[model samples]
Target: MTTALLLIDVQKAWDDPSWGVRSTPGAEANVARLLAGFRAAGRPVLHVRHASANPASPLHPDQPGHGFKPEAAPRPGEPVFTKSVHAAFLGTGLEDHLRAHGITGLVIAGITTHLCVSSTARLGANLGFAVTVVSDASSALSLDDGEGGRIPAETAHRVALAELRGQFAAVQTTDEVLAGL
Candidate 1:
């Protein structure tokens, strides 16, 4: 079975502190490791960059944050899919590309674990792809839970991973995935 690495929204905007403290402090390093592993294994690598339409947002097209973080930047020949929405497949043609390339499985990692990463993974599962989410290679930001209390980033990240496990993905760590590959 062919597998591809899907790195989503690992952009410079995540470095901006205005978004608040994020979970998975080692996420970037782990993502870099996953990238290196995928390249070494001669596996396909796809990137999803989030571009906010809102001019005031850090991820707006005119902002530097719209570009990828150095550690997760795509190489010259790698495909980069840009999207304005949360799910990578929404308007990106990512699923089509994967199908065209005969990719039957996906290893996903990225920033905002509870958002883009989770959305993409769930969609992938529903589309019949074998999905594995790298826990250490994804991060999430803490946000108001709507009741005036803040949900810690770590909690959100863990909960998202848990939700994806078994149902949407097989959650694994960087080391575990690399060693298996």
Candidate 2:
């Protein structure tokens, strides 16, 4: 199927360890796999970057770190959405860009499994586009009290995967996504 791969918010902003929600382990490798697939297929690989209202945060629109990481920077002609909110469509022309290319399907891969990834997945479904949430390619930070109390990252990741599967978007592993697309 000819579909756009929306690499949601895989920026240095979210990569900060201070954030409770960052890339899950192996996330870089997973994103690398998805990027490779999209490149091979000659499919559009769109990046969603957030511009937080907080001026001090690395995600501020004017901050240099608000862009994509070097590993997955958009190539020439690739679309990049600088969103002010969780959903990429909330404050950007991402929808119009997709429509212009006749993209009716989206494969999502990015950071913060519970934030931008989830929000955009719901919107993508509501917008009537077929959506797939790549399980391995997205991540949320592990919860911890630092007193030897913490929820396992894998467990939290599994929960996000289950939640997005039947609702936000169809959840699948990077390999599954590769096979489908």
Candidate 3:
């Protein structure tokens, strides 16, 4: 099975100290490791960026900060999938792109463990792709209410991972995925 690595949302907006770091947990390191591996392997790396409807938001297409992080920028020949929703498959030609390249297996790795990572993995499985989620390659950001109560990002991440493992994809650590590759 030919596999492609789906590196989702390793964008500057998500890595910003002001807007993103406040909520994003352990994302920087996870993505860093994945990027390094992809580089060494010279594999296909598709960077999926989320385009927000909010004009002034950081993820706006024209925003420089909305672009991929410098460390993980797509190489000259890499494909980039831009979309408006959590799942890169929504209205995007990502699935078609994968098929065009004869990629039947998807190695998913990215930020926002409970959101985009989970969403994409589940959809990839439904779309009939062999999918595996790199456990250390994703992260969950914290959430809070007006009352100052916060939900720990790690706690939410673990719960979501448990749900994703047996259903959507295999929950393999970066080492596990790379060791066999």
What is the C-alpha lDDT profile of model 1 across 9-119, one tens digit per residue? 999998888999999999999999999999998999999999999998999989999999999989999999999999898998998999999999999999889999999
Error of 1 at 29 (Å): 0.4
Task: Give the per-residue lDDT digits (tens) of candidate 2, residues 103-134.
Answer: 99999988777677888988889998888988
In model 2, what lDDT does residue 160 have?
Answer: 71
Q: Judged by lDDT against the true structure, how good is candidate 1?
A: 0.95
Best by lDDT: 1
TM-score per model over all chains: 0.99, 0.87, 0.88
Clashes of each: 0, 0, 1
lDDT of 3 at 98: 90
Off by over 4 Å in 1: none
Tens digits of per-residue lDDT, candidate 3, 1-181, equal 7888898887777755554333335555666677677668876677898888888877888887678887668888888888889998998899999989888888887767788888999999999998898877777777674698967777767877899988889988877877756
lDDT of model 1, residue 161: 97
**Which 10 successive residues of model 3 have the least lDDT summed?**
18-27
Global lDDT scores for all candidate models? 0.95, 0.82, 0.79
Candidates by TM-score, descending order: 1, 3, 2
User: Residue 3 lDDT in model 2?
Assistant: 89
In angstroms, how far off is 120's CA in candidate 2?
0.2
